[model samples]
Target: MDPVLDDHMHLDPVNGRGVEACEEFADHGGTHLLVLNKPSWHYGVEVEEGGDFQTAYDHTVDVVRESNEVLAGRAWPVLGVHPALISQLVDRGYAPEEARDLMRAGLDTAAEYVADGRALALKSGRPHYEVDEAVWEASNEVMRHAFALGADLGCAVQLHTEDGEDFTEVAEWAEAAGIRREHVVKHYSTGGVVGPTPSVLADREELVRAAERGIPFMMETDFIDDPDRPGAVLGPKTVPRRTRWLREEGYDGALERAHVETPRMVYGIDTRATLE
Candidate 1:
């Protein structure tokens, strides 16, 4: 069996099933996972409470660290403020400047975690491409902070963004921020275009096309870990399950490259992959 890795998933203290989810993944033949924090819409994380972002940011850091502990060296953490959180704050009457300030603080804290060896990458980027000017600019500034931090710390960033015309535009953004092109990733990529970070959730046909493209990429489910939705984004076993299927169909080379080598090179996450 080829050791498989999930490059992205959310399992915060809000849902309270993150650890169990990781355990289930390992039990199902997964080798590694990257745990992400849910900044909003999980538990009582509304920004209207207490001293605001710092408290939540600290809590998220703890959440990621604890997730690593639960996985017992099988997983690492990707920390940041999701762009949706900032955009919603703006819609909730917070000024764009205020929203950007909070996001910068969150990115700074994530970078500190990387420094401490507690986390691997910063999960930061705009939610989509069609946002209003003010919201878009604020998210861009916040992500700029994340990019600069990733560059300084030699870490990678997983971007959650909407559809766009050209993926190279993203690479240009990373260059302008002084971050390496390999350090930037487009999360939940559909494999519709050629880019560096196309860990696609597309169908078998699209994935085979991506396989033909042969540009190094990773695979993910973006499993939201929401009990209410119950595998809303994707089932937990999706990647490894596909990995096993690939093995059966003689796509082991593709699995090893995308599931192991690409993630290790791009995000610095190395799993215990053994040749079968």
Candidate 2:
């Protein structure tokens, strides 16, 4: 079987299924995961400054560590400030400019983790919903900073943004920051419309369309792992199960691209090696 990798997912040991979720994935034949940190608020950390995000980042590292201990590097961490944090900070009484600065600082801290080799990628993006022009610009600025950091570290940066974004502006930012366009990935993306690279949602139709269109893409579950919303985006087994479906349906070429080729190209990790 091709090595099945879910490119984006979260594990909440505190309020969610945690490492058990990873076991479920493994049991279902998932060979690897790009485990991202949940929001700071999810960890109950009130971020007044950049350093405040350290606690949340640390927790994320710990969770990823535990996951690796269980599955021997089955999970890799992607740390960064969640983009909606702009609104959250605003609601918490921070000015728009202040929130942007704090988010940049947070990404700086995440970059520190990447620098230390605790994480394999960085995450950042603008709000998916509507927001004020100032807020939008601030979010874009923060994401640009992430791109710059990824460029410096030679790591991939996963973006969480509103649907239907072509990422042309984002591509320009990545270029200016000196990161490859392929490294700027749209997490939870549905199709080739996202950008040069997309960590596409693991919907069969979308996956088939992405393959048929010949877009460079990866697959993700976006599995929240929150018990309250059980199987909200998708279950932990989705990617592996989908991989099996693809094989059974004889999409041999698409299977290789989604599971092995794209992951090695984007994140620079050999999924097949992880299983060895």
The positional error of residue 111 in candidate 2, measured at the CA in angstroms, is 0.2
**Each prediction's TM-score against the native?**
0.88, 0.96
* Full-model lDDT, candidate 2: 0.86
Model 2 spans with C-alpha error above 4 angstroms: none
- The pairs that clash in candidate 2 are none
lDDT string, candidate 2, 1-276, tens digits: 458888998988888988888888888888788898898998788898888888777777877877776663377889999999999999989889999999999999999999989999999999999999999999999999999899999998999999884778788789889998888889988866555488889899988888887767888999997888998699999988888887888888888888788888888988888875
Who wins the lDDT comparison? 2
Predicted candidate 1 versus true structure: per-residue lDDT over 116-195, tens digit per residue: 98777888888674677888888888887888888899888888877652578767778887887766878787655554
Worst 10 residues of 1 by lDDT: 49-58
- Best by TM-score, which number? 2
